[model samples]
Target: MKIKNITTFLLKVPLGDQRFYSSQCAFPERNSLLVRIETDTGICGWGESGQYGPGEPVATFIETVLKPRLIGKNPLDINVLWEDMFTGIRDFGRKTTGIEAMSGIDIALWDIAGKFYDKPVYELLGGAFRKKVLGYATGCYYRGEDVLDYKKSLQNLKDEASGYIDAGFTALKIKVGLLHVKEEMERIAAIREAVGNDIILMVDANHAYNFHTAKRIGKFLEEMNVHFFEEPVVPENIHGYKTLRETLNLAIAAGENEFTRFGYLELLKNECLDIIQPNIGCAGGFTEAKRIEALASAYHVQVIPHCWGSGIALAAALQYCATIAPSPHTAFECAPENSPMIEYDKNVNPLRDSLLTETFNVNDGFVQIPDGPGLGVEINMSVLKKHLTKT
Candidate 1:
C-alpha cells in the first residue's frame, strides 16, 4: 500500500578478535546502520547500511533529510523512490555519505515491495535463477602480534581455514597485502595446501598496494592458482586495475567500495576486471544493483556481490544474486568459481543472528535462498529494541 512511517537505528555490534581479520583487532566495529520502513497496511521491511564514515550522524541524515521526502510515497515504486532520493541531493551530487543514507531507505522500500507482492524479493525481481548460492568464509586474516612472524600467521591461517572447511565451506577468502609479498605468498600457499586443490581460495588486500605491488602479487597468485585478487590497488585507480588485469593471469575483483551503476560503468569500460562485487545495501540496494548486474551481463561479467555488513546486508545480497544470471565469463572483479558462492561474514552481531525469527542456515558450503515474503526473514523487534542505542 502506501508508506506510513520510517525509522532508523545505529546499532553497534561487538566481534571477537578471531571473528574478523587481524587488522580490525583493536576496534569494536560499529557494524550496521539499520533502517525500518512501515507501510499503512502494517507491512514492515528491514534494510541495512554499513555504519562507516563519521558516526551516528548518518541516522540523522536519513531521518531529518531523507525521511520527510519519502513519506507517503509508494513503496512499490522503487525506481521512482530511488530517483527522487538521488535527484533530491544531486546538487550535493553522488558518492557522498548521503548516498549511504539513501541506500538504507532504498533497500527498505524494495523489501516492502516484495512483501506487498506476496513474494520473496528475488521472486518479485523476476524469480530466482538458482535456489542455493555457494558461500565463502571471509574472516581469515593474519593473527600475528606486532612481531609479524610468518610462522604464527601461517599456522593461524591453516587452523582457521580448516575450521571453515570442516564447517562445509567449499571456498574461503583471506586478507592479504599487509605483509611482504614473500610472506603473503607463503600464507596463501599454506592455505591452499591445507584445504587441498579442490577448495577455492580468494585473497583481498583491501586496497593496500600500488600498481607495481599488485602486479608483483598478481604474478605470484597466478602461480598459486589463486581464484581471485580483490582490491589489489586503491579503489579509485581503475586504470591500475586495468594494468593489473592485463599483467596478471588471475581474475581481479573489486567494487565493495564503489557506489552505483555509474561508478561500475567506469570499471566495465576499462575491461580490466572479470568479476563485479556489488554490495546490495551500499551500492543502491536491489534497485540499482540489479541494473548494474544487467550492465555487467552485457559485458559477460559475473556478480558475486560483496557483503561484509550485518545479516540484513547478507540477505539482501543473496536475494539479488539468486535472480541475476551469471555471465558466461566470470563476474567483473570478485567472482567465485562454480556454484556461485556469496560472501558471508562470520563475525558477531546480535542483529545478524537474533533479529530474525529463523536464522539462515548454511550446509555443505551453500546457503538456501529465503522463500518467505519480502526478504523472507522477520525482524525481532524485541531484539532490535534490546540492541538499539538512544540518541
Candidate 2:
C-alpha cells in the first residue's frame, strides 16, 4: 500500500510539577510532536519525534516542509525516505527544527511499515530476541524548591527506592551531581542499604559538573558500588569523558542529547562511554538510532536508551529495546516507577496515562514487548483531542 497522507499533531500535555522531576531547565512545559501516517490500505501508524525542540513551531515545519515530500511516497522505503529527509535538510543545520521534523516523519514511516506488514515494529527490525525487557526506576530527583535537603532527601530516596523494589524493580536510578559530593555519597549509601546488594543502582548527573568534580564524584560512586554514572559532564566534552573514564572504574554513560549517527560515531570512536543512551525520539528517531546501536555494537558498548518523555516515547523506546538481541551491546532497560513497567510518568502528564487504549503494564520489574502492529499500542483519539494543543 502507498502512503496516502502524513499529519502532525503538536500536543501540549500538562505534566504538573512532578515530585521526582524539576521540569527540564530548557523546556519547563513538555510539548510533544506526534506523527500519524495513513496509507491507502486503510492502515494507520504512529510515531513520536522530539517534543521539546519546536515548542509548537514543529507543526509548521512538518506541514510545510515534510508533508510535501512525504505525501505520495512509499512508507516502507524507510532508509531512502530517511536519507531524502536528511540530505534535503543538511544545509539547514543538523540538530535544529529541520532534523526534529525529519525525526517525526521518519518514526511515522517505521510505524506505517510495521502496520503494513501486520507485525510489530520490533519484529520488522528483527524479531524479538526477548519477549520482555527488564526495567530500572529513574525518578530519584531532588524535591522541594531549595535543593533536595541532604538528609531528608536521602531518606526520601530510600523510601521511594524501597517502594520500587517492593513493586518488583530489580534496579533503580537516581539523579545526582546537583548535591555536594559528601552529601551525595551519604544518599547513595542510604539507597544501597535500603535496596540491599542484589538490586542494581545507577546515578545520573545530567552533565552538571566539570571533569574534575566528575572524577572526584566518580571515585566516590565507585566506592559505593554504583552501577554507572550518566552525563557527568556536558556531552560535547570528549576530553572530559576520556579523563573521567580513565580516572574512574565505574561505567560511564551519556548521549540522550546527541542527534544522529554522525553524532554517535564520535562517542564510539573515542571509547569514552561504557554505555550509550540514545533517546529514540531525539536521536534521529528509530532509523538513525538503529544505526547508532549498530555502531555501538561494533565498539562493544551497551545501549540503555534514554526515555524521559510521555507514553508514546516510552512505547517507541520499548519497541527499540525489544529488537536489540542479547548481544554485548545491551546492558538493561530503564523502567520508570510512576506507572506500570514503562517510563511511568509519576507526574500529571495527560498523554502519559490517559492517551493510550492500553498502557504498558510492568510486572515483576519487566515489561512485555508489544505484539500489536506498529508501535504496538493504539493511540486514544478521544484523549488526544482533549489534550491536543490548539495554538
Candidate 3:
C-alpha cells in the first residue's frame, strides 16, 4: 500500500508536584511529538520523536519537508526513504531536529511494514534474540524544592530508591552531579545502604562534570560497585570518554545524545565507551539503531538503548531491545551485567503511562516484548487529545 497522509500531535503534561531536576536542568513538564502515518489502504502506524526540545520544530519539519516526499512512496522501502530524508539534511541536520524528525517517520514506516506483513516490529527487524529483556528503573532525581536542603533531599532519594525496590525493580539508576561531590557521595552512600548490596545501581551525571571531577566521582562509584556511569562528561568530549573508560573500573555509557551509525562509529572507533545508550526516538529509529547495534557488536561494546519518552517510544525500544543478542555469545548463563537491559523511566509521565491502550509494566525486573503486529501497542487517542499542545 502507498502512504496517504501524515499527522502530528504535540503533547505536554505538567508535572506540578512531581517536578524534579537532573544535573543539567529541571523538568517541569514532559513533552512529546507523536507522528501518525496513514496508508491509502486504511492501515496506520504511530511513532514518537525525541522530546529533547520543543515539539513544534520537529512537527513542522515532518509536515512541510518530509511528509510531501513520502506521500506516494512504498512504506516498505525504509532504507531508501531514510536515505532520501537524511541526504536532504546531511550538512546541517545530522544531530538535532532534522534526524529527530526522520526518526519518527522511519519508525512509523517500520510499524506500517510490520502490520502489512502480519508480524511484530522485532520480527521485521530480524527475529527476537529474546522474548523479554531486563529493565532498570530510571529515577531518583533531585526534588525541585529540596535541592538546597541536603538532608531532605537525601531522605527523599532514599525513600524513592526503596520505593522502586518495593515496586519489584532490582536495578536502579539515580541522578548525580547536581550537588557537591561530597554531598553526592553521601546521597549515594545513603542509597546503597537503603537498597543493600544485591541491587544493581547506576548513576548519570548528565555531562555536568569535567575530566577531573568525573574521575573523582568514578573512583567513588568504583568503590561502591556501581554498574555504569552515564554521560559523565559531555557528548562532544570523545577523549574525555576514552580516558574515563580506561581509568574507571565501572562501565562508561554515553550515546543518547548521539545521532546515527556515523556518530556511533566515531565513539566505537575511539574505544570511548563500554556501553552506548542510543535513544530509538532520537537515533533515527530502528533502521539506524540496528546499524548502530551492529557497529557496537563489531567493536565488542554493549548496546543498552535509552528510553525517556512516551509509551510509543518505550514500545519501540522494547522491540529493538528484543532483537539485540548478547555482545559475545557464551555457553554460560547470561549474567545481569552481560544481559541486555532497557531504561524504564520511573519519573512522572502521564503520557508514558496513559497514552497507550496497553501500558507496559515491569514484572520482577523484566519486561515482556510485545508480540503483536507493529509496535504492538495502540495509541489512546482520547488521552492524546487530552494532552495535545496546539503548538
Candidate 4:
C-alpha cells in the first residue's frame, strides 16, 4: 500500500516528586516523539523516535523535510525509501538527525508490512527465536531531595530495589555518573544488601567519565556482581573503548547514541565493546537494527537493545529480542540467563503504559512476547488523547 498521511506528536508526561536524575541531568518529564503513518489502503502503523537530551528535533525535521518525499511511496519498499532518505539528506542529517527521523519512518513501514502480510514484525524478521523475553527494571534514579541528602538517597535506593523485587523483577538497573565515586559505591552497596544475592543488578553511567574513572567505576561494579557497565566513557574514542574493555573485567556496553549500520560497524571493527546497545527507535528501526544484529553476530558481540520510550519503541524492541539468536557469551544470553534483557524503564509515562490497548505483562520477571499482527500493539486513541500534551 502507498503512504497517505503522516502525523507527529511530542509527548511529555510531567514528573512527580520522584523526578529521575541521570548522569546528564534531572529529567522533568518522560518525553518521546511519536510518528503515525496512514496508508492508502486504510491500514496504519505507529512508530517512535527516541526523545533524549535534544527535544523534538526529529519530529520537526520529519514534518518539514521528509514528509513530502514519503507521501506517495510504497509502504513495503522500506529499504528503497530508507536509502532515498539516507543519501538525500547528506548535507543535513545523513548519519545523525537523518537516521533518527528515518528510524520512525522505517518502523512504520514495517508495521504496515506486518499488517498487510498478517504476521508479526518478528516473524517478518525471519521468525521468533523464542516466545518470551526476560525484562530488567531500569530505575533507581536519584530523586529531588534525595540528590542532596545521603540518608534520603540511600532510602530511595533501598525502596526502589525492594519494590522491583516485590513486583517479581529478578533484574534491575540504577543511575550513576551523577554522584561522587564514594557515593556511587555506597548506593550500589545498599541496593545489593537490600536485594540479596539472588537479584541481578546493572549500573549505567551514561558516558559520564574519562578513561581512568570509567575503569575504576567498572572495577567497583564488578565487585558488587553488577551485570554490565553501560556508557561508562564517551563514545568518541573507539580505541579508548578497547582500553576500557581491557582494564575492566565487566562487559563494556554502549552504542545507544549511534545511528546506522556504519556507525555500529565502526564499533565492531575496533573491538571496542562486548555488548552493543541499539535503540531501535533511534537506530533506524527494524530495517537497520536487523542488519546491526547480523553485523554484531559476525564480530561475536552481543546486542542488548537500549529501550526507553513509548510502547511503540518497547514493542519494536520485543520483536527484536524475540528474533535475535541467543548469545553464546556469559552474561548476555536470551532464554536461560536472559542476557540482554529488555530494558524496561520504570519511569512514569502514560504513553508507555496507557497508549496501547494491551500493555506488556511482566510476570516473574519474564515478559511474554506480543503475538498480534505487526508490532502487536493496538493503539488506544482515547488514552492517547488523555496523555497528548506538548513538552
Q: Which candidate wins on TM-score?
A: 3
Model 1 per-residue lDDT at 282: 76
Candidate 3 has its poorest 10 consecutive residues by lDDT at: 330-339
Q: How many residue pairs collide in each prediction?
A: 12, 2, 0, 2
Report the lDDT of model 4 for residue 281.
Answer: 85
lDDT of each residue in 269-304, candidate 4, tens digit only: 999988899989888889999999999999989888
- Output the number of the lDDT-best candidate: 3
Q: For each candidate, what TM-score against the reference?
A: 0.93, 0.90, 0.98, 0.95
lDDT of 1 at 269: 87
lDDT of 4: 0.84
Candidate 4 RMSD to the correct structure: 2.1
State the lDDT of candidate 1 residue by residue for 1-391, as single tens digits: 7888988776665554533344323444535688889998998898887544543666787878888998898888889988998888777737747777877888888788878888898988898878788888886665534426777567777888888899999888888866788887888888888888888888899888889988888888887778899889888897899988888888899888888888999999889678888887778888888899888888777777888666787788788878877556345423355335788766455667777788888988888888878888877778777766743
lDDT of 2 by residue, 1-391 (tens): 7889887777775434543442234223566778888888888877777565554666677778777887788888999888888888787748757776777777777887787788888888877766777777776667654455777566777888798889888878887776677887787788889999888778888898888888888888888788789899998899899778878988898888888989888988998998788878777888888898888888877777888656778888888888664444235523321111234434345676778898777888887777888888888898888767752
Error at 38, model 4, angstroms = 0.8
**Candidate 1: misplaced stretches above 4 Å?**
16-27, 51-55, 144-147, 329-339
Each prediction's whole-model lDDT (CA): 0.78, 0.75, 0.90, 0.84
lDDT of 3 by residue, 1-391 (tens): 8999999999999988888888998899999999999999999999999578889999999889889989999888999999999998888788889899999998899999889999999998889988888888998888856676777667777888999999998999999998899999999999999999999999999999999999999999998999999999999999999999999999999999999999999999999999999998999989999999999999999989988889999999999989988878876426356668988899988998899999786789888899999999999989999999863
